[model samples]
Target: MRVLVVDDERGLTRALQRGLGAEGFAVDVVHDGDSALEAATSVDYDAIVLDIMLPRRNGYDVLAALRDREVWTPVLMLSAKDGEHDVADGLDLGADDYLTKPFSFVVLVARLRALVRRPTGARPAVLTAGDVTLDPSTREVTRAGSPVDLTARETSLLEYLMRHADRAVGKVELRDHVWDAPGEDLNVVEVYVGYLRRKLGRDAVVTVRGTGYRMGG
Candidate 1:
């Protein structure tokens, strides 16, 4: 999918370009807010990565302008500020998602992908993929309207995969987020995925040869 990455840090943007390109995204980058606003208004992008701090115009101003003009492309806001108000402000200004600085590349990708997978400018209460549906509020999972009882750990694993549906999430990413096991063996990831497959059907999760696994593939 086409993505616009807006940031003044050339080095970081370059790294993002290489990484996101490898993950199968067409990335176009702009350094300052004015350039970002120009490119975003001129191009039809699937998603956008907007940093809060920028030269000439700030991200909030650009975002407000986009929303005012009815540009509803999914936007993932970025900033060094981690305050709750800072995040709330971005969302209030029509940001689809937000990430603080020093964020995990994997999580950032997952967050952006989640926004892209959903309807533009909407976040559903229930996440669904084909016949499978998950309710984050109740920790409930159903396949074809039938409840699928799973352990707490299994549910956490399934939740992570479902949140990042249609993307091949790496083992390291899964382990760290789901299991909170930073140094654990990848074998654990394999075993839990196997559990999910047995309960959710073999086709529920697809195994990418060199990558880790993908749900809703």
Candidate 2:
């Protein structure tokens, strides 16, 4: 999975990247809200680790913009402020979950895993397109009843494509939606698309020529 970590505290961001990477996530870290918003806007993240206090834009503003733009990627807010109102405000602004700072990394990991396992919050925990099935709750993928093994990036990409199934999602859209901004240059989109094709099979995603890519039978 790909995760974007936004925190003004450099140490915490680095620690998160290191720890989450060790846990098998492709992690990207950024320090301020401007870069944070840019990253969030431009890349695809399985989930975002955002802080309330930030430079240029507050986490609330960033969260609002994301929702306003219809970016539904789940967000896990991390902040020093643990006041009831602060948590409520984050939730109200469309954050999927919240965690106060000085937290246990174990809890953070658990929360992230939960988010991955249930991206849509639906009870059955299954998503499908054609013969493909993704069980977010189980981190499992099956196509025509056979298992498909995907690397973290491939899984994140496939999830994004499936979430927007049948729509011609442009490379720029995929880039901004799937990969965190700073860690990616323009070519990362093509690279990961190639990765997805290899792992999921050549015809799993279709190129729309001048448009973008679409997922569906």
Candidate 3:
């Protein structure tokens, strides 16, 4: 496996190169964030070992840029600052894993192996259907670049439909999953569907005659 090591510490970088090379990994080392970003975008490494402190730009900016450009290569962020907020910031920006300074080399190798073995197709937090977008984390929805306010039930219902976009979802199935209970009134599904259609537009949710509904304009 190939790995990109982005760190300014020459001794640490050299030691990692030797250790990781011995473990049958082809390692390329870069000393700064700009170089890291350039190398990451130019070549598709199996995984990246990125350090938080670097020249020109920091690791957060580098990882953000990579994700913004749709580069999904797994990243392992390294840092001397082990604060809770620091770790959260790195993860929130898309670093797959994090290691603080004074970490074990053995542990680092194991983490890298685990990261590379993980499935790379982690879904984006946001979901979109045509011009409609839903952020489950924020419980926010927007249609055609405009905010669309929705109640909790409507949000849950729309989220379900959007998740199963292009597929006709039955009312009973919707109730079973999105509603309070499977035994709850099925008419509520129809009511919410109507609410979604009226709020989002008539064509937002398509009724499939005998079947339930599909999301998309």
Candidate 4:
């Protein structure tokens, strides 16, 4: 799934982007609320990690604006403030969850999974295409009763394809969804699709000539 991480802390943002990307998520990072607003407005993200304190606009204002604009993407607020009142305020601002500073990485990942697992939320933990099954929560993929081992990037690609299975997914869309921007100059999508084909077997993914790619139903 795609996520937007909005934090003024450059180090934290980078770390999260890298870490989450490795965890099979497409991540975009912006250091301020304005840029976060712009990106969130433009793209469809699975969730947003918004910091409570920000320049120009606080997380509360940003969350309020998103709701006002009818962008109902789930938000997980981050703050140094751990008081009950602060958490309540974030919830009041329409945040789905909150994480205090110095939180556990494992716990944070679990929370993200919970947000994604909500049927009404953006990301989904389970996805299927024909006889192939993928479980994002467990990071497992099985086809025809056989387990498929995949690299992190391959897993991200397969998830995207399965989510949009039976539909034409162009190279650009794949790049946007699976690859972090600025995308690689090479034909990375084709390369990874080839890798997945080799790993998952030839019948798994189909190439649509002049279009892009798709997972067979």
TM-score of each: 0.57, 0.68, 0.56, 0.90
Ranking by lDDT: 4, 3, 1, 2
lDDT-better candidate, 2 vs 4: 4
The predicted structure with the larger TM-score, 1 or 2, is 2
- Give lDDT tens digits, candidate 3, residues 1-217: 5689999999999999888766545578999999999999987576899999999999999999999999999999999999999999999999999999999998998787666655265545677998999876566799998999997678878877886796999988787656433477889989999999888998899989899899867
lDDT of 2 by residue, 12-130 (tens): 88888878776656678888889988988887677899999999999999999999999988999988989999999999999999999899998998898788656687524576878
Superposed by TM-score, candidate 4 places the C-alpha of residue 146 at a distance from the truth, in angstroms, of 1.4
Write candidate 4's Cα lDDT for 21-40 as tens digits: 88877889988888889989
RMSD of 4: 2.0
| Per-model root-mean-square deviation over C-alphas | 10.3, 4.3, 16.8, 2.0
The count of backbone overlaps in candidate 2 is 10
For model 2, what is the alpha-carbon lDDT of residue 101? 82
Clashes per prediction? 0, 10, 0, 0
Number of clashing residue pairs, candidate 4: 0
RMSD in Å for model 2: 4.3
**What pairs collide in candidate 4?**
none
Candidate 2: residue 177 lDDT (0-100): 51
The global C-alpha lDDT for each of the candidates, from Candidate 1 onward, is 0.82, 0.80, 0.84, 0.85
- Which segments of model 2 are wrong by more than 4 Å? 1-4, 18-48, 53-74, 81-86, 89-95, 109-124, 180-195
Ten residues in a row with the worst lDDT in model 1?
Answer: 175-184
**C-alpha lDDT of candidate 2 relative to the true structure:** 0.80
Candidate with top lDDT is 4
